[model samples]
Target: MQNETTKIALLVAIATLIFLLVPVFLILYIRSYNRHKKNHFLEKQNMQQKFESEMLQTRVEVQDQTMQSIATELHDNVGQLLSLTTLTLNSVNVNDEEKARKKIDNSLALVNKSIKELRELAKLLHGEQLVESGIGHAIDQEINWLNKAGTYELKVNNHLVDLQITSPDKDLIILRLLQEIINNIIKHAQAKQIHIDTYLEKNKLHLKVADNGIGFDPNEMKMKKSGMGLNSIYKRIEMINGKLVLNSAPGEGTSISIEIPYP
Candidate 1:
């Protein structure tokens, strides 16, 4: 009887051990699952944070570009025109009434022109609003300013003017990209002709800028890291999952084509 009792107690002890271990194993499993969930949440949160940060940086860069363009216009175009007007007025002489009259009339004409240019500059001051109007309008405004220089023969075809969709973020990036391209052209291309085409097809936006400029080998430029503007273009394009193709050769014109998915 004592042996039988001993066996029963031993069996009970084994069963109790297993029962206690079952709860411990279950607790461990639950903890592991919770940890995985937490890690996944953190990863997603990090990605969102990174995206926001990039977007903010892009906005600031765009604003800076706009301000720079404004400064250039004020100094190179408007300021020069006003200065000429002033000079013409200062040279006026009462004794030579005929010449003085002509000078006054010329100054009047220049003042009118300056006023018009100032109005355009005002539109540009609202750069963000220009983007709000639509990417097409914003592009047209930039092209108009470029045309004012009368340095380049511009041929443009923009079909997204009546686009019903809007993507503000992408629009800003696109505008900045165009600004950078134009800056590069003005600073280095020495081109007399520029052709720009923009349209949307298959839910993809396409922009092409071709210039009759003194082109250089793109591979050499990339190797030399001399095209800082090109580098910036690539970085911004990649951020938006866009693609860019550049074609150029020495003595040949340069053409840049960009494709991006649209809303």
Candidate 2:
């Protein structure tokens, strides 16, 4: 009887050990599985980010190529055709002066229209990829457009010629800044003089757009009211992690200074 009791006790002890050990082993196994799963998820996220970045880069490249092609077509094909048509009309051998004059007038009108369209297309093309070429090239292109368009005397004093601003967001920042400034001048400034200056200091890039026009106080917006031009300019500068400083008051002219970190 004593031997049988002893054997029974040992059997019960072995059974309890197996039961506890099984659950502990299962718990450890589950923890290891979860860790592996989490690592895999992180790796997938990393790969996805890389893929998105590559796709964005490719899209930009394609857009730039397309803009270049359009510019070429406008300048070479459309412009040449318009010029040829005008020349042909001018050289028409007509004895009747009235008929010749009418034809000449029509040809002149058509030529002017075509030139306007080509110029607009050229500006669009130039703006699209100006940053890739550099800030100086971009400013030069804008000056060229302004000179040809006769909108205003767009002067630029680009001190930092080799300024390395390679941010993907640089183009948008420059375009919005310039467009807002020019549009404001056209609509409200009523001034013939406009100047743009660029300088860099303490790893920050600074730009100034000044015009000899009717200006308003920046602090007295509630008193004088801020127009769409001023509001849009401020919003755009803010979007690019930059700040704007307005140095103007009523009858003092407007000067806008923008500062952004150099990338």
Write down the lDDT of every candidate, Cα atoms only.
0.90, 0.71
Candidate with top lDDT is 1
The most accurate candidate by TM-score is: 1
So what's the TM-score on candidate 2?
Answer: 0.56
* Model 1: per-residue Cα lDDT over 155-263, one tens digit each: 9999988988879889988998998899999999989999999999999999999999999899998997757478888988897899999999988989999999996
Summarize candidate 2's per-residue lDDT along 121-178 as a digit string, tens digits. 6656655566566666666655555665465766779876676666645554564566
Q: In candidate 1, what residue range of length 10 has the lowest lDDT sum?
A: 224-233
Instruction: Name the lDDT of candidate 1.
Output: 0.90
**Candidate 1 structure, TM-score to reference:** 0.80
